[model samples]
Target: TDQVQEVLEAAGKVYTVLKIDEVSNLGAARIRVRSLLAALKDQADREAEAAADAAAEKRGCPAACIDLNNLDKLVPASFTEKADGVVAAAEVEQREGASTEFERVQFTEEMRDAGYTILAPQMAPYHFELLVPIFKRAGYNAVLLPSVDHGAVDAGLKYVNNDICYPSILVTGQIMEAVLSGKYDTDKLAVLITQTGGGCRATNYISLIRKALKSVGLGHIPVIAISFKDLGEDNPGFKITPKMLYQAIYALQYGDLLMMCLYRTRPYEVEPGSANRLFDYWMDACKHQLQRGVRQSEFRRTVRRIVEDFDTLPLAGEGTKPRVGVVGEILVKFHPTANNQIVDVIEREGCEAVVPGLIEFFLFGIAGGIFQQPIGKSKKSALGSRIGLAAVKKLRKPVNDALEKSARFHPPADIYELAEYAEEILSLCNSMGEGWLLTAEMVELIRSGCPNVVCTQPFACLPNHVVGKATIKELRRRYPESNIVAVDYDPGASEVNQLNRIKLMIAVAKANLAEKEAEARAARDAARDGAPEDPEPVAEAVEVETTEVAE
Candidate 1:
């Protein structure tokens, strides 16, 4: 154990030490040790190359010769020549004292008194819509921008690089369109966007928004970064107190519950708009409670009531619709506009949509920290990761309990359980945008009675490609009855093509449902005829796997 520890320490790595006595076979142990050494050598080579590239870049030589870290920077020198005109125009603007520094909006008492409205881009309708009032109760004037339309997408493409992820385009476009619409006074307006401050390009969205604003002559409007970390510390007035954080957490939980209930009840509601009307009612009520400052006990009681209200809705239809789960990149999975209103399309195709709750994403993010520690080389990171996992788990308990009380809703699996499930196929170190969480969500969906899934993602998102689309085969092998399809959404992707693919998935889902129903009928007949209560197990439903790539 001491020798192994020394070897690992020399390699600048860490591992759980096992005693030599624990190895039952010396030959097997030797082989495992050799494999570990090989992996360490590969890691060391990569690090040495990265260091060399950094040294070269520091000496003003292009890092591209040694490292392909950033694909965007790998363009040909001719691309730079082509950009000269744009650069020259920008330089002229710069000379005119055009501010390059991204302005941060401080949520001070003065700004609040002046009624400065903070505009946030809408991702999930119920979540964002309810979040507005939560911000208001916490003493900030906040509003979620309206749903993204064709105009928003067009406006987004105008300001943002089309090659970037679709979610960023829509978000940036929505804020830009809102500013350009001249609907609000520019002086009193500020745009709020979340910064993950991580490897994901989403952290740079604030910079993108600032540049877009500068280009559109809206740079005077402050851009506030909404992040839990110090990334958004430029605005000291936007204090996230413990109380405010508590309320916000509950708000998210409630939003997810409401969304779940809405999706479940909407398709079968006797009245066309009954579920929507109730949804609106709860939105208003939740907002009112937020304004009054809801207590923890009060929130718990309120959630139960909210669930009961939705449960009471008249669902007069057949109620046996094919259930389909939606999973993918966070924005594309939840944002209706980004995916061209896919949930509605699923319903139109005679299926009930089951969107995994937003809270699971939060849990997945927290649990990712715990997983990172085992493979991570840094001690500080490991410690911080452990602390973060514990803190989030503590916060998650109440929300998890509330979700459990909502009888009709399928409570999300524990974060550790999700990580365990994901580990069976994906490595925990595969932490990127969505990462292992995307794969885990698919597994969760299949486990939680929704076997048919639609994995929505931006066209060619590498992380999703690795962890999402790539994991489907393994998932199908494990859950043979599972039917999954990957749908790519992009600016040029046709709605007709997307829907046609989904229609086929729905066709398979209907057949699977029919088969299951037939098996159930057969079992019932056997029981009635005084035969064996347990009939022979039904054969596995044929899997329908398809990848719908956007043109």
Candidate 2:
């Protein structure tokens, strides 16, 4: 055991497990091993960064004053004047000699109190619309950038490297396009992006945006990166507080529940916008609840009300529409513009669009630490992850419970169960971009009576290309009735080609629905006539139709 441990240590591998029962007392050892690993990794980096790294370790977001007396004379009246909760604005000074980790941008501590117009690219519209309000309540003035146009893509192509995934291009494009459009004050502008800190190229998106900004002579604009990993002191003023994190989690739960309910009832509403009207009402209500700083009880009540409101949408004459599940890379799957309005496309084809909740993607990420337990550096880190996951699941209980109780809705609740399901096909440790989660979502979608699915992939996303498009045949083999179409989204991807593929999938789904209905009718008739129902003949007609659609 000592020799093995020595060998493992030499390889820079972590093994915290000894006796299994030792894991039972995490409170006794709450130290974070991941930080130690990060420190080691940082030290091994280029020696030129040594001084900057040392200064960063000791740096902190300073307590700053916010008053019109310190503010610029030309500052806008609404911004300079004190708001209900915020202090009067102060002049945010550009700091000298900050670590230009990305490029030549310097973000000072004063920006935290300055309330810069944070332009965050809209990923999930429903989620962000609900979420940004919570962020505002947490003291960050965040705005979800409106969907990008052709100009946005063109801007991205001109500024950002064209070789990356479609999402990066689109995201960069939106930010740059917004900046170039002169809609906001350039001096008081910032861009917010999430960094997963994973092996995927997405970890470097902040740097890409910074580089793009530098290329456009706007390098002074701070790129505020939202990362769970601690980026040392030479950074932006924005940081995630515990309260902010808590509020954000609830916001996401609301987003997921709302999204699930909206898609569930929208396609079947008697009035065209009945479901949307309900959604709009609930959105404001939930946003208010989050803004006012409610406890879990209020959140639970709000969820129940949300579900109840959506339930009242008065569904149209629906024997049943073929439900199409949309699962893919986080951005493209949720952002309508990114995937050429995929949910709308599915809805237009007379199908219920079932997008698995955003919370599930977050769960997959949180579970990654726990997934690494076997080879994890410290049992405490694994314990922390498990505890975090459990807490999130606990917070999510109300949303799931509300969803499950509703006659009109039922969304997936358990991440562990999902892991177990996905483990059948691929190892959970293979956590890259989407990785096993994509395959798992497709599986869950099919198993939950929604067999028709659309897997959206960014044209150049290698991880998704492997896990999503590559897993389709195997998924079909497992669930023979599943009608799946993988659509790739790129700056130059053909919408017509995508539509044709989707139309083909929908045709198959329609044929499958027809066969099932015929089988049911035949069963009823055979029972009345005291004869066994023959479903094979019923299947033949649909099969012929499917072949024609294929052709």
Candidate 3:
């Protein structure tokens, strides 16, 4: 009886806190109740839609928002062939299928033989799930193991002596969580860590991982340091097989294509899960084709077929819309972590959401270095410039090709001019780091027809806060009618708060678009300008905030 009383007390308090209706009149109270019920109904509908999308994703069709079916095979067979050596090593380990100790010894030996260079903070498109595919495509026989999570964070808290970055903790936590999940075998498993050799405590992440292994009594496992600093592996040499590179690049290209398709289709889908269903089918097809050695010509043919297939999807939305561009920190902008599904929110609001590919992040990072060093073009700096430019062209070529071939989808001009357009922006925002670059990108997005830009970033991320917050004023000043908003994510933030902010931003964007169209109409009448009239106003957008945090 006492326990029941206690439970009732708790429930009552909860209801009291949530029931914020302070209407003084019966009419006001009725309106408030009706609005609340309507909001609840809308939420339930969205949940049902998401659930339907998830189901469609499971059914091996395209995801309602994205498709991966037909991407140009970005990585050629040659790259996979080159990665054969690495695969051979992993095969040997599996074949030896020996005890954990033996496998560890073998792995160590292989690492030393190939001179496995660990890239510090070695982050990639596919962290763990896609590592095998990436390695296979890259023609490398490498295994990516999650490093110490809790241990690394604890170590960082102790010795690294730096303000804790959320990524570091999340990465660590993800590893730790995976470890505890018992899905991974720590034995014979060598976790790869990147040591940047920089001032950032990020350099210590590897050491922390090592320490973590020891603390967890998993010290026997090898810690492979993937670095660009010519770090030597004594136990074994590490080599990249051509195949792994091919798979890695292909996977990323496919990911990009999928992202692009999803963004394009989502804004006006009739059936909620249609885009996602196609994505699943496309992934399965890509995997199968890669395994079967599909002909290059056939590959293009397959993509065309898939695009035709997607185009045939009967899904339709309510209205014509303005496409908005979303650009910001890579994780926040793309990951639900930072933006709380801002892209989806924008789409739901009856607008096309354009998110640039991950390649731009890489391009910006490289360009940042060159701009930072004025002497980059000198004889001594010639090698760096050559390398940077080569990388830019190499990475950009496929993207450019994809865009060129895309009939239904056209990437914004800013994306085509990414490397070239980034130069001046880099110079102007050097003080703000990559955040400033992201802001500039968002600004460029607005300038290039995406009247609305949303900068998704972590709350209190110094670079992001400075760049995102400060650049808004400049963006609006330059593009007076620009609709811009920065959504911040942190552990304790409420979904309601986040959604409310985004809704407000979208409202402003809608208002601005309306005013612009009105002005254009007025101008059209005055000048008899043969220009076409403006697009009509869209229905109010439905904004939902559901950003997932590591916790």
Candidate 4:
């Protein structure tokens, strides 16, 4: 009763709508209260929406007014403002059949044949490295932005709205810096931003990049939006054929397999550079395989070879180091620059960084749409997503089989498993930023023996805060042994502060591990002596805190 009371207090004050003792059965009490609470919550939400709509009517268009409000939150001045006569100026331009050139320029099919260079942001190092070759084989002069430098941040700060998320600034900066560097023909250079067509601001970054470039006198450089969605601006200039798509899929599988192998093997290798040297060799080999158009069987053979090489590498500390999982916004979670070399920092702190595979994120996206049929997802769209999900599973079998056969490697969890893990705390409908997948990764990591976790994100991402930081207390309650920390990266964030927080989490993890080992030894001794008595429960030392700490 005391423990139950403590848990209830930690969760927040619980109101008794229908007392369990007052009802005929416990299940009836829960059902009655659930229905009542849901009806009241819906009513409250509707009232709030109606009130917001009334206020927005006075302010202008509801959606635009909301956007304007978000933009002007930290300052008195409006971030998006037009001059008083701008509407009349637009009318005059309409009458004269001439207009100022703020219109978006499209990348036509001609640009592809002309050998225009395509610039994409660096998200996953291994995945993009593999993709560049796959892209070249299909004939696109592709270049992943080499790095996100300070100059890019300066450029982004100068043009991007102050209220935008930090990732948008970094990405915007990287793109603009590349355009201004004179590295490519401004007339023929094109930039690419992958969009999910989701509710996140990332879906609109294409326009933000375009606006920034136009402001810097580099408007002639076309900004291309790459996506599976049938958007009007989805690059008529470049096309991905069915064959090209399959090759890219294999690259994702190989890149994930290689990443898992490298992170697992590199920290403990007997030879200082052997793990990295072998990884580089395999990356080159896989690129060639894709270029040569390897069959599914051939791809499976390569996977086995890659695994055998990594597994056979001589290592000292196979399981000595505690595993720490990193989860959050995709770019910051995977990219070194965005998170300030967190994987390296984790290894340096005597822990192995266990990042979730990148492919699962794509799987989560496809799976989300399939499950959202009751909430506006079309039947046809849901069917397509189901087929895509199944196809991805079949496509993944080669790598899965190879990993399952390895002594040191293991395959990533299925999308359905991740969804089940997330369903405990949050609905799959909570899909934005990293969405429920963020919470799901922490659960998966804890269950997979990586109890210490670092959840990284840009400071101002709303959905991240909702799904990442907001769920920590509940997660702590559900899995008391887990030690998790939330790190938000911003332009002005301190790396030293971030390091100290990580060290604290690691300290707790080490203690937990020591306690677990001691318990195991005691259990072994008791088993040999006759009857074993119940052991005392181990109390978790780390407590949940909602404060933002930068990574």
Clashes of 1: 0
Ranking by lDDT: 4, 2, 1, 3
Residue 230 in model 2: shift from native, Å? 3.0
Ranking of all predicted structures according to TM-score, beginning with the best and ending with the worst: 4, 2, 1, 3
TM-score of each: 0.74, 0.76, 0.61, 0.77
Q: Model 2 over residues 168-273: C-alpha lDDT tens digits?
A: 8888888999998989888988888888888887886887788788778888898888877655424646667788789889888888888888888888888889
Q: What C-alpha lDDT, on a 0 to 100 scale, does residue 493 get in candidate 1?
A: 88
Q: What tens digits encode model 3's per-residue C-alpha lDDT throughout 174-235?
A: 44444444554555355555443333444545555554455566666566665434544433
Q: What overall lDDT goes with each candidate model?
A: 0.78, 0.79, 0.54, 0.81
Please give, for residues 1-551, the per-residue lDDT of candidate 1 as tens digits: 32344455554564443236765678866777777788778876786577567767788766537444443377687886876677577545522323335555455667767888888988888777766776787778888888656777888889887867887788888999998888888889888888766577677788778878888777777788877456735665566678877677777877887888889999898989999999888888887887777787777677777777886788875459999999998888888788889889999988899988887776666555567776754667567766776775665555566567655665677777888889888898887778898898889888878899999988747778889899999999999989999999987789898898899999999999999999999988987986755334222111212222321
Best by lDDT: 4
Query: In candidate 3, residue 225 scores what lDDT?
Result: 60
After superposing candidate 2 on the true structure, give the runs of residues whose Cα lies further than 4 Å from its correct spot. Answer: 1-106, 233-236, 374-378, 528-551
Runs in model 4 lying further than 4 Å from the true structure:
1-101, 147-150, 524-551
Q: For residue 59, what is the lDDT in candidate 3?
A: 86
Instruction: TM-score for candidate 4, please give it.
Output: 0.77
**Number of the top-ranking candidate, with TM-score as the measure:** 4
Model 1 deviation from native, Cα RMSD in Å: 18.5
Model 1, 278: alpha-carbon shift in Å?
Answer: 2.8
